[model samples]
Target chain A: MQLKRWLNNYVRIWGVYDMAYDESEGEGVWIYCEQEKGEIHPVSYELLNKGRELADDLNTHLTALFLTPDGSDAQELVYRGADRIYLLEHDNFNYPNEIPFRENIVKLVEDNKPEILLIGATHFGRSLAPRVAGALETGLTADCTGLKIEKGDFVQIRPAFTGNILAHISTDRCPKMSTVRYKEFDESERDTGREGEIIDIEPLEYDGPDVKILNEMIIEDINIQEAEIVVSGGKGLKDSQDFEIIEELCSTLGGTVGSSRPLVDEGWISRNHQVGYSGNRVKPNLYIACGISGAPQHLAGMKESKIIVAINTDPSAPIFDYADYGIIGDLYEVVPKLIKELREG
Target chain B: MANFSIIVPIKEVPDIEKVNFDREKGRIDRSSATSEPNPFDLNALEEAVKIKEEIGGNITVISMGPPQAEDTLRDAIARGGDKAILLTDKGFAGSDTWATSYTLATAIKKLGHYDLIICGEKTVDGDTGQVGPEIAEVLDIPHVSYVNKTIERGKDSIIVQTEVWGRLYKKELKFPGLITVTKDLNEPRLPTLTNKLKAKSAEIERWGLDDLLDTGDEKHFGIKGSPTSVVNIEVPKEKGRKSKIFEGKDAAKKMVEQLRKDLGGI
Candidate 1:
């Protein structure tokens, strides 16, 4: 089959044809190299870094695939443990749109089949992966925090039951795909001594208008992913109206406002604002939570935040145990006073 | 407009979380592992049916799981797919994402004439959201995941809204494409009584590796083909202690003082 030949060619490119033919477990794995603003996401590096270990264990060549539009250069290609980098570039891919992004990825798979594929479980990864899996008629696990090779198979480990349990899912089919959460693994230390083959391919052409990128509303606000200061609230704020206090304090302190699952449940904010295992994982310089009881599920989301500040009326609130700064007071009274003083200064 | 052939990849997952685990033994004694249509996959099926209504095409529901997964395919048929395929075989067990995607891709190619593929954003069990994109990687197609809304569908491209870097991108995507929908896409319809009966009697095609992957490379077909594996299972240590329940004004006063110290005097 053309795919088999293509795989062989790829193997030869890596100078690891023997490994690909003999040791590559299952089919092979496709690693989606995540990038933002033309720069690869750190998590992408981490994935490749970890993927290499996985590929080697399974005797497979770790392959990297980049999906970007025209005007970009594939100069950053590296083996980083990858056997090959499938470079796909097109003007349509310059900006990330689910349709075109996924379309191009699917095209690569159709052309060269890999047994497994790894994607970072970032916002883009979470948004783009499922569609591609659907297209391939396969299974996918999301936000996998761990991965490894077991008995010649890849075991995709992910948090399940609202972070209450860890589920290990495996498919009997080739190319078992899963996304790894950011910060789950360390990025491979850059070792220039290592090198791999890079393959540049023509972008897949489909007749219909590849989706138009109408607007790129860049939030000037520090991305929560990169923010050093975060002030989050929970359902205890009660209503949309109460969120003002949390927002005001955060604004005063020049920090971003985040929320626990309760806020999303209360419909006080969008899911983007949510913090927990189900939401964003943040590690900021200072994380202040007002009126959050710090449920295990909620703590699982933000425990990594460097310095935590907890304010609640309940002295026994779970949030206190994790807070570097614990306050026992009415958040209603405390937040406003804090906001006023910060403004005066 | 040409009739678009839509394929909805489905899954039947054990409600493993709901099953009580014997902590002493640390095993899922799934005497209670109830199977459900993966919540998101159900949403994918619903979206496929909705698209079928708007686009006028056959919606084929397909899944790769144990034979028991046939129940889910029948459920999809009842919900409104024109046909269904269940890719199952004893050899297809303990597959990782790589092998899973490869097998499914082979099956899809065998099904033939699929214009669009749709899937749920993520399954409840795995929650990794990798399989979809991995499949896209294997199929070599463009893919979009976590689609919030389908704004418009052009003859050649479909316009959709999805989040990128916390920002929503509304753009047109070409047809003969693939997309994964989130629960927010639409409300799923319950199966009709008559349709349920029809599905119950429907002959779901059960395809094995020989039928689906006759041309697939043996190296990439199943567990032996996967690369990554879990090193070990260590339960993350619980980070915080239970909140100490405080009572009344006295507790409130003590709390405020603690706050003053943390806030450096309120």
Candidate 2:
């Protein structure tokens, strides 16, 4: 029995090797344009922008798979750099449903056969991308921060092992798919003169057991990712109430209030305000770290800021190493002083 | 109400907090790190145990890892898992999320019957959050990700609240479905002394790739079956700054001046 099993494995390995080397017949770079409430998510444009570069490198057209409700137009996607738009219109597309979206996407992917596919790493995309990849039996790299066409290979780069290591991955399968985090790449400038073909496709009718959204509550908090300046607090704060100081400083700077993971885990602040590898990645114009010791995970989210200022009583704090300017003083003293300075100035 | 059978897939990962990076070598020093059950998976197990306690059912915990992962499965059993199965084999090494989910879905198929499959939002090491949904897709069942609360459990369905893009959604999913839970679900509980003792001596069921071949193809079992491969790994180099340090009462003032000069006023 052992020998038979070994033989089976050997044969299967060889079979897989043969299949892996088969040249892909797929064409074009595709971006899954996610939409909500009749508006295209901004990340879709970002993907289109990046997809255009990849498609250009491969000398192919950039295609945007726009699934939206009836009456929505795909012209904006063309303006964003898409050479062709495959628009699927359905009333069900107005809200997010995993099964129908997955079914339709899987069918489209099977029929069109794009060489590369990129989707936003938003909550909706993360849930939908994997199911589509699973149905197609293709590999998908999640939350990719970088993408490149290296020597005709579609390379997907993402942080792994708690953001300490960056892994560059390549797929040996067709329709190489990746989910890129929003804000990781810049969106292309709108070009009204750009021309593209819009092909409206029929949506798949899914009658399977589906998830029904009973209630939807849109959160009304400041999106820290879009903030120009961010004032963040960390474990250095003696108490949760000290967040008030952070808030004061943030408001004085007309910025958003952010916190490290520990504060969010402690329930002292909402998860939306947390900034780190596991939280919202922010690239604000100015970032003030109050009492943050600067763990690698935290740095991964905000290190791209144009200016970083660290305030910690400990001069040896790791945040100081990354901060453009460091101040060695208690946040209680320095923060209040800064708030006063900003208010007076 | 009839009792429901719950299956929770957990993973053992390197202790993220204690993981050491050899910056010069551009690699992680795995030898210096201790392994622990992925924290998010613990939340999954806790939710499963809570569901079983409320509805009176069996909870089976499954994990795919090396032989050392048995310890993690034992830990799960101690925490409230009724039965633990470890999917360990040399052939399973180097499996990415696709192959891993396929193997797990195959093992789940061989488990006969289950009402629900619960998993952590994502593993700390990979942080992909793809396996749970991928497994559901392989099994052809409905799933919800980032579920934070269970509002109601009906005879044939479950109502859950999930968070997506800073929005809250209350969704109801039919039975025989899957759900990936977030950290906000519930606080995990410690094991009793009796349960801890029992789990220590418990005989964990071990299933190798051979055991799952009846339901899954051998080509889809490991690296050979994986569609994606890592071509290179790099440790991001830390960019140095001016590191101008200031102190005393006027420190804040001096820092403001420097920021104004460099940034053209804050």
Question: Can you write out model 2's per-residue Cα lDDT over B1-266, one digit (the tens) per residue?
Answer: 44678999999999887789887887889888899999999999998888887877899999999999999999999999999999999999999999999999999999978989999999888999999999999899999999989999755788999877467889999988999998888999888899999999998999999999999978888998899999999887767777778776687777777767776655
Highest-TM-score candidate: 2
What residue pairs clash in candidate 2, if any at all? Answer: none
Q: Which tens-of-lDDT digit does each residue in A40-89 have in candidate 2?
A: 88999889989999999999999998888853569999989999998888
Model 1 chain A weakest lDDT span, ten residues long: A16-25
Query: What are the per-residue Cα lDDT tens digits for candidate 1 across A160-253?
Result: 5556566676654445777788887878877677777778888767554444566566654446766767889875686788888888888766
Reference-based lDDT, residue B77, model 2: 95
Candidate 2 lands at a TM-score of: 0.94
TM-score for all predictions? 0.69, 0.94
Residue A277 in model 1: shift from native, Å?
2.8
Best lDDT among the predictions, by candidate number: 2
Chain A TM-score of each candidate structure, as shown: 0.76, 0.91
DockQ comparisons of all candidates to the true complex? 0.25, 0.74
Chain B TM-scores per candidate, in order, are 0.92, 0.95
